[model samples]
Target: MGPDDPDRPVKLAHAALHRAGEPLAFGGGVLLAPGTVLTCAHVVNQVLDRPDFAQERPGALDLLAVSFPATGRRRLRAALAAWLPARRADGSPAAEGDVEWSGDLALLRLLDDPGPAALPVGTGPCHAGRPAYAWFGSGAPSSIAAVLVQGVTERWIVLDSTGSAQPVVGGYSGSPLWDRAQRRVVGLVVSRSGLRAFAVPAADLRELFEEAGEAVPGPLGVEDGAHGPMDPVARQLLGPLRSVLTTPEALADLAGRFLAELEAEPEPGPEPATGPGDDRAGVDVGANDARADDAAAIDAGAIDAGADGSGADAGFPASAERLVRLATARPHGAPTLLALLAGAARTQEQQSWIATTALRVCPEQFLTAAEHRELLTLLADGTVPDPRRCAAEALPLGPDLEQAHWPEAVAELERYRPRYGRFPQLLRTVEFAAAAAGPGTARGLGAWSEAVAKRLGLAEILLEHRAQARESAERARERGPQRGAPAPVVQVQLWRATGTEHFSYALHAADARGRPLHRSVRDTPVPRSRLLAELGALLEEVTGQVEPGAVPVVEWFVTGEELDLAVDQWVYRPDELFPGVLGQDFLCVMRSPELRRAAFRPEHRYRWQVLRSGRLALVDRQDPVVQQRGAPVPVCGVALCCPAEEVPRLRAIALAVGVPGVLWLRPADHAIPPDRVRELVHGAAPYQLPRLVYEARLTESPDGLHRNLALVWDSPDGHPETLGLGDPRD
Candidate 1:
């Protein structure tokens, strides 16, 4: 085929060959049956030229190496079966003297089937001008299309070479010229001359098979094809379903059609009253007359099997009853078609009908786990009738029921178990509930066996929830968070160093802004509590830092190594020691220099706080002092310059500092001259920043101090939430 035409069907039937001792004897074949192959007779001649074929006759050969031409991954072997040597109609070898070859064919019977796709030989005529596809399994097999020119003889056909872009080459000798419209192989390629090629007609191949006394496979895509006419019993039962499936449609579209069919059919009469202690009054009549009435009811469709297949006197219409019956009967394609219909149902009505029908047919065989889950969902939602009975009967007992809203299912099972008695379904449901309930609950299954023993009257059921409740009560004596006066918010800088054997850390305690309170670096690993004790002692020296009990906020920075240290012995070991110290009151945040430097922009705001003997000092935005010539630029708006690793940090800092419009600088910005910043800040119309800060100027794109700048202040909401993140490096 052409590059775009899908050839998977043809390739599945193609096979290739490799024989011993003949270097130029590469050939191809088509799978004619489960273990049967058809190829050119000349290919067999080339094999006979080798020494390996000298002693072996048909049905006596050891093995012949073969493979799939399309995907030659594994080599397989087939045994020589029979050969129809290239010959004239006069019974002389056609390859000898001046005689021309007519029929050239060879058949092989594989010892082990390689599961190749089988293409039946067509019995119908392959006429001229019809499109034909030739398939081969070469090193690079081609399944290109060609047209049939003419039938040269009964045993040979000529291929139209002008339109056949792909001609018969070395490995194309045994390829089948498949009739695309016919869906069958009509001939096998034998040779090519000038612009034309020749193929052995499938009729002659069939004759050869008959002469060899092998059973001929039937024709394809015809009335006489292999899967024959539908059974009369199945047709009678599935007539309506078959009519719905007669039209070609996708699986998903079948739901609408099936629903339409259901709607068009008449609804069932009202169900007979069924209630506790009333069975004797309505349906039973009298015990002596039961058998005759039941037989009549069955004939009239008054009673049908329930979803559990118990024949439990459930009411259903004649039409629905037959639909379920045929579905269970495997009527023609009913089982497969109904499965597709059930899978495609999207609405509650559709799912309910399909699921209920499948359950009624044979739940154990038909219902999949997902279908069961859907049924359980309906049960939990209080949507279906007699859900408890459905759950106990239709639902499989396992962790499969332990899905969302499982608590409702558990409650249903628990409430109904006693009434269900010793039924296997009910017992299975109880076992499922017990195993599914997770640990540390009063519903612990320690008393399950005891309860069973008590039910059997062998022992008393012991209560197990009391000990668990008492243990929970005793655990209330543990310590709680200290309820003292507020402490000053402390700014802490902790440096962490990783070495060959242990972690060396330095702690720097300070007041909120940058006043140093204490500094110490531990030379050896010490308990975090001991270090906290030493820090508390330093807190007593606290000249200008503390209140009574104000909560402390710590911001820590760690550099040196990344999170991946599985290769090393000395790691952070946070799971053992640091995790406990770092919870709740004591919090540590790690920072990198790249992130900190990127966050340090001049135009943004930074608020400072000071604590002096429990008194507070707070400072708001302070403009940067001019450090350059030619009228130092004022902090008119915010600008963000950060590396890729610090985007989130810069985002938080920009909001924290109350910056105006932001100008994000890339890593490439550092390589640019310092003079470039002047151009970026003041090169454009100088008053643009002032106009944006005060008058709220609008432009096509955001107009800022530089063409490349991002205008955060111009955001439609004028909030940090709308300041969309952008990568400036690109």
Candidate 2:
């Protein structure tokens, strides 16, 4: 075996050490089974956070919390099952002064379901001068550390980081010691003294298990030469998905996104630092990943140098590969990933293959593909569904409800609580990998979904929407700006300092393509009523900046998950003959500086340009089939076709995967006919929406749609920050 095999990562999962807690990682341990971990007894002591050393094994797991560091912060609760304390020559308890001690091995049993891809352990000989590797924990970038075997003692192998990039330090305890030459974990790093570290060899571990009359774990098979192990049946099932892959980079990208979904969302707080043996990375002294110090991480860069030119570690993204291998081996892997992509209607043959090969796979999985697809479909182009809301409660869900009866489908839907960014953020994420799986994946999935939705109990519309959004998301420019000067507009800057949700805004008189109006008054704060009054006065003063006959568009820049701001309801002048509603009086829109901070993505510009051409889609949330009725138009803006409280957020996401103008009515008490609302907002050019609504509001019908109209008209071309949009959070 050669050092730096990309395949080494497959085995990294076996270096399961750490209690499920902060500072990630305990001392390294080799995974013996899906639920069992083996490490040093002292390392276990430290991981439990008992200041003084206790040789006795934990009596129960009630107090234990174990998690693999490479797997983010989610805890995998566990308990100590076996304990072999260090002993002196006379069989007395070993002391710190003892140069050589025996039997410092322990086994841990997981109380929680660890999912698929348990670590596969391989044995390697303990030899001096051999290269060794380890990592602090998982999920973090570049945590691998390399070292060399200095010498072998009676009970331990010594390692030195003399010529390595990083050394064995405080947090490296209990981490698996991978033998670079053998391509398998050879020992557990027991303790460290500055540059020198001590580890119990794999032989010692086997001896510990055997002396207790336990069966020694057999060696796992490694195939594909250096690319590493994969379930053969899974590999067969995914043949189509693999064939459609454009590049290894694409696969890696999907894998990264999948892993990112599992980790904690980035929050405003201090996170533990990186690097092995770093005190904060672990919970206790001598902790490898946590204070247990299970830093069995291998050097990631070493993956670049595999046997056949590809890095051995470069085979698959470690976490994703592990999950695929683990889940699909039981045959649930592919289906779980294909959450919204599965269905017999889309490809009955593919679905049937799993049944034919059911006996062939282990770690079995069951799926309700159509139903899963249905839930996702509803999410794709429509409103956000409450996880607890059931089909029995949905009106006109259509009669195609058979798939909803699929075993565990609704239960699975209820279980889907995503920590990802926003509403369609889930839709975008789930569909990305499926789209890359094969050509027509989007189309096939859409058709099956549509069939289900036609009667809808909701399948077809969702299918089509997901396909369009996903395809468009990819085609959109990742980064760029719109061409030409943005339209004449008034820019509003709403700044709320950290530690508060209340916002303070300023109105700016912006000229097209001019400098960004930067204003943040973190120190001087005002009440909501006073701020709105001041904002109203400022808006009145800035309306003069707008060219004659052009509507004054007020674009407010806000950030984070803030969605409910009554910016449109503010009264510009309460004392005047007409104290007009801000949204009704002018073109008021909300712009997320955080979302648009990168400036205008091509999608933003693409739609903005189309709106310039007067093409807009009128979509009724109640019955949106009209947009699909006629030939597809290059619509740049969308008529929200309903009141503010009524439109699905996915509609906003669908108009443009990046950014596009949206127009709707403010929350209204009375419903208007869809045709009337459409003819009113949809008939006018996208740019003329504000003026049309303004004129209509002054009509004799004071309760008309015009009085309640609201437009989120954001065009990168005429955006407030034609200068620059640098978010304060950035």
Candidate 3:
């Protein structure tokens, strides 16, 4: 039948049987054929030997009863009829026989009618490739699967049905076989493998009937001009014979009636297979069968009581009543009920009873927005803990919403506030608001901020406010009193003698008495040789031409800590006139002062005194009056030329001892005239040299020309005195 045929049955139409006390069970033509049944020997063998059957009932020795469609009530009836025994020829008890050991097929004769029509049998045309329909029951439904005849034997016909082309579960030992074209019984279902299915041919059944001493029924014949069977006339029949016996309208009407009856009735429970040797002596088979029919009525009453909450349905409780009833009555009711409820909720209408039943039956399937909201509220209020927990776990947010959905989500949160008054919900709301505002705008942020402020208390707020205030103060200014101040200025003075190569610059700072300050060298690349020459000339001019009776002083206001010796030392020249050491007589004055001071000590009775005018006074030893009136004598100026390196120290000492000037004496040829030296020193007057000189003395060469120069100066002097030997060869 087509899937939509209303008269088509959705359940199995055949019954199976086995020896009640043995482990043999066979199914198929037994229900249709009362006295004679066809079955595969393998089915009988399985039940006769199976351990579970033997353990359930011990004594097995006779007839077997069969039930069609093996549902719950049917199985119960079969179980109760297990005591029935098979009868012998004289109506005596018969022993159970194992049939599988015999061959591939078997036949049994019932003692009484099974209340059904005799199974039809047909003679095949023996075509090798004709298609046939096979029916089998797996204790479930009877389904027809296609098979093609591969070969024919005297008793068995082999069919090709394997892999995708395999027949539907034809392994059931007694399943029926029918001709699809004529819709009539053709053969009994039998054995199958990957390559072929084997069936008991109708001719074999005829032979078995003759062997049992029964007359074989003639095949339903066709008219002289017709090509098919005519008995029971294919156009008037239904079921496997409907295509051949019935008209389309009749079939449709019958199918519609069958469907209506099926819908009205509740599903039956499972049934057990019947076997031979069941006790039937005290059993009321008729009354038990009646109860089996009433079982469906009882199931329906249970469903009604559960639905209406009557509390009288003894088989069902409130929590599971609705689901059980719906599942029992309708195969596809669960999803339909839930869908209707969800639909109603979408339209903002009241939820119907069917919808609620669906949700109770299959809550996981009802995942609509309204249902979700309801579930959340229920969860918060603890109304439905189990379902609420399930919804929460399964329906977390996924990647399917738009940005605008967040506002709706917020509204949902507000609506459910009374239900889910937990900290997590509040926190999540605040976090969502902050994120939605994009770190810039304050939109929807007030609630979050207020929540936090309320939660954190005032102390935290005050601490944060103070921290911000301090940060503002720090950023307001770039500098402070302790940083980036100007350096102190130091006053320095320069002096030298006329015609001398020695010159001095003094730093008179109270903090730096002995050391000469150094300054930064300019970035310009003045040649080293030119710099030395200029420095030498400048030294000569400052030291050579100093004025008598006044301290030579050139004041410089220096910033920064140290001075540049190379630049500061070059500030004074030997031949330049200053109010300090001057002329050749200045050196004589410097040398003579030591000798005069030594003689005028208290131990020498103050014999003589040296004066600033280059004059020395002599004292009498015993004449007090003459010693007191000692007159000064003037000495002619004379140059004692030394190496250049000795000039800085000598000039330092001279300036320290208060000498006006001192000349740097050189060999006569090496020295220029005082006036010429003055001009050379003046030419380099702008250059400043270091105030203190560092001297490295050397032994004289064999020719008397000193290879090293020694520098002399006091700690307070402006520059060092350098003295060197003249070239001896000259």
Q: Which numbered prediction scores highest in TM-score against the true structure?
A: 2
User: Model 1: what TM-score?
Assistant: 0.29
Give TM per candidate: 0.29, 0.29, 0.23
Candidate with best lDDT: 2
Weakest ten-residue segment in model 1 by summed lDDT: 608-617
Q: Can you tell me which runs of candidate 1 are displaced by over 4 Å? A: 1-5, 21-25, 50-63, 97-99, 115-125, 135-139, 142-147, 212-730
Candidate ranking (lDDT, best to worst) = 2, 1, 3
* Candidate 2, position 615, lDDT: 65
lDDT of 2 at 272: 32
Model 1 residue-pair collision total: 6
lDDT of 2 at 591: 68
Error of 2 at 617 (Å): 1.4
Q: Write the per-residue lDDT of candidate 3 for residues 1-730, one digit (tens) a residue.
A: 3555321221233456644543333455433232444454445445455431121232331445454443332321121211212223333333344211112444444454444322323332223455766655443343556777665553466777653244545445567665555434556666556556677654345445455454433332112111122222111111111111123232223323322433445345324223433221111224433223223323333222222334232312221222223323343333432332233232221233222223222322322233333333423332211221121211122111122233344333433321111222322333323332333322234333443333222324433323332332232223332221111122333222224434333332211112233222222334433433543444344434333321222333221111112222232224466422211112111222222122222212111111112221111121222223223322111111334445344333332233222333233325333342232223211101111111101222243222111111111122222211111122
Candidate 1 lDDT over residue span 233-287, tens digit each: 2222232232233322331144234333322222333334556444221333243
